[model samples]
Target: MNRIEKRLEELKQENKKAFITYTTAGLPDLQTTAKLIFAQEEAGADILEIGVPFSDPVADGPVIQNASYQAIQKGATLTKIFDMVEGVRKEKCEVPIVFMMYYNTVYHYGLEAFVTRCIECGVDGLIIPDLPFEEQGELKAVLAKNEASPILIQLVSPVSKQRVPMLLENARGFVYCVSQMGVTGKGANFHKDIREYLAAVKKESAIPVMVGFGIRTAKDIEPFEDIVDGAIVGSNLLRILEESNYSVDAVKEYVSGFKKELNENK
Candidate 1:
């Protein structure tokens, strides 16, 4: 199993929920990106999702959009992002890392080439937001060709209830249960029936199920504690960095605080 699979399975066995963190690559420069990766790992993040900045980040809200734009402006290309991952791996950060990118980014990079690079970079999984469930066959084939290739992570939402089973048919790593129907951002209002949705997902998914999208605070995780395996915090982390003037120290402080709250659930 890849790192993501092994890590999530370990959490499940330990009766501990995952506390995942996502940040855009090359944000304020790749140096800071590398630092952020290690900081989050040091602070008890179970898994790390590194976002590859695309020209049009449709799934991202303002916080990530602005951060991505600045990243691209500072030359955050796929090659450089992969290099950052390789560097982080060399530093002995064993936490599983997943790449969150658009299908277009992977397409232009060539399917075989992309998967090969992912294996080389030590990425454990992929979350391609725009990739349709029905259209994942080609990518899946490429991934299967390599033993160490990163797994494709599936996403389920309240609106996709009817298709949850289909979307999760051959899901690897863990299932990403989108907490809301909208784009990624921080908000108190998740789906009205999020608890039910999460329950349904748990019933349908054979692998671990994690909730994301609007998850902002530690308290948000409490609601899903019984229903899901983990909570993924996104946009608000960028807000923390911005508020702290992009300090990696602040990111560690924030993740450390949230992890402390997560441990209390057990």
Candidate 2:
């Protein structure tokens, strides 16, 4: 199995939910980003989603947008991010790393080249928020060439309920189940029908169903219970890193608390 599948299966065997953490690569700077990546893994994060800073992050909220802007100003190129991943790998961090980026970034980098670099840098999956299922064919081709290649993760949005079966069928790695309809940030109240939506996704998904977008705290994780296999926290973690001036200690403390919250049911 690929890293993503292996990690999730391991979690399943242990009867534990995953705590996936997202942060923009080269935020503050690449050096700090490298430190944060390792720190998150050390602090109980099951997986890592390192975002490629884009010129226009349409799917991102205020916190991630600001972090992206800072990363751009600090010369956060895709090449630099790859180097950071390689650096982390050299230290023997076996945790799965996934890149959360836009389609344009992959297109600009050349799809084949991008996928090759992902394999080289030890990235296990991709989460292109804007890449529709219909258009994933090209990238999927490259991913199929290698058994351990980075898989293009599938997404299940509120409006895509009708397509859940098809989406799950085509899914690799895990299913990214969006928590709400809005951009990525702290969401106070989920839609009343969220439980039903998650239930449908769980029924159809052959792989783990991981909820993202607006998952901020332990309270946010409580409602997911058996509905989801994991949670992805992006904006709130970015906000915490910014607030802590990119302190690794701050990231570790936050992740420790978040993991505690996630495992309370276990």
Candidate 3:
């Protein structure tokens, strides 16, 4: 099994929910991004979703979009992201890294070439929010042949009842359940239906259901702890990193707060 699969299995066995964090690769700078990643791991992040800065990040909220634009301006590219991952690997970092990217980036890289490079870079999985279920067949075949799993984001809206199972079947590492309907970081409050939606997906999915998109605090995760397998914090982490004056120490501190919250709730 890949690192992602193994980690999820371990989390389940230990009865512990994963604390996943997302950051735009090369944000601020490549070195800073890498440092933030290490800090997150040390601060109790189970998996790291490294966002490859793209021009049109439709699924992202303002925080992530701004980060992507900044990273792009700083010369972040697919090659740069891969090089960053390789650099981290040279340090023997064992944390699982999932490239959270858009379909256009993969298309630009060529599907086979993209998957090949991901395997070569020690990447654990993928999260392509733009790749719809009906269109995932070719990518799924490539990933299966490579022994790499492509993670799918399960957006919870009124339409999820029809789409969740289809999304789950194609998903390998875990099912990312978006906590709200709109974009990545726009939700003001967790909807009342979130618990019911998580329960429904959990009942139908064999993989772990990881909640994301408006999750900022441990309190946000408390209500769904029993119903979901993991939590993903993105916008909040990105905001913290940006507001931290690019201090790696600040990044670590923010992640530490989340860690404390998760543990205290546990």
lDDT of 3 by residue, 113-211 (tens): 988888778888788888877797787778778555444444445358877776676557788887787788864377678788888989989888888
TM-score: model 1 vs. ground truth: 0.97
- The superposed Cα distance between candidate 2 and the true structure at residue 94, in angstroms, equals 1.0
TM-score, prediction 2: 0.97
lDDT of 2 by residue, 132-157 (tens): 88888898888888776888888888
Comparing 1 with 3 on lDDT, the higher-scoring candidate is 1
lDDT of each: 0.88, 0.88, 0.81
Candidate 3: segments with Cα more than 4 A from true spot:
148-158
Candidate of highest lDDT: 1
| Off by more than 4 A, model 2 | none
- For model 1, residues 1-266, the per-residue Cα lDDT tens digits are 78988888888788888899999899888998898988899888999999999999998889999989999999999999999999989999899999999999999999999999999989999999999888999999999998899989998888888998898877888999888877889586788898899999899989998888877877876776887888898899988987897787899889998888877758
Q: Give the candidate order by descending lDDT.
A: 1, 2, 3
Query: What alpha-carbon RMSD in Å does predicted model 3 have with respect to the real structure?
Result: 1.7
Clashing pairs in 1: none
Question: What lDDT score is found at residue 139 in candidate 1?
Answer: 93
Which RMSD values do the candidates have, in order? Answer: 1.0, 1.1, 1.7
Q: Which segments of candidate 1 are over 4 A away from where they belong?
A: none
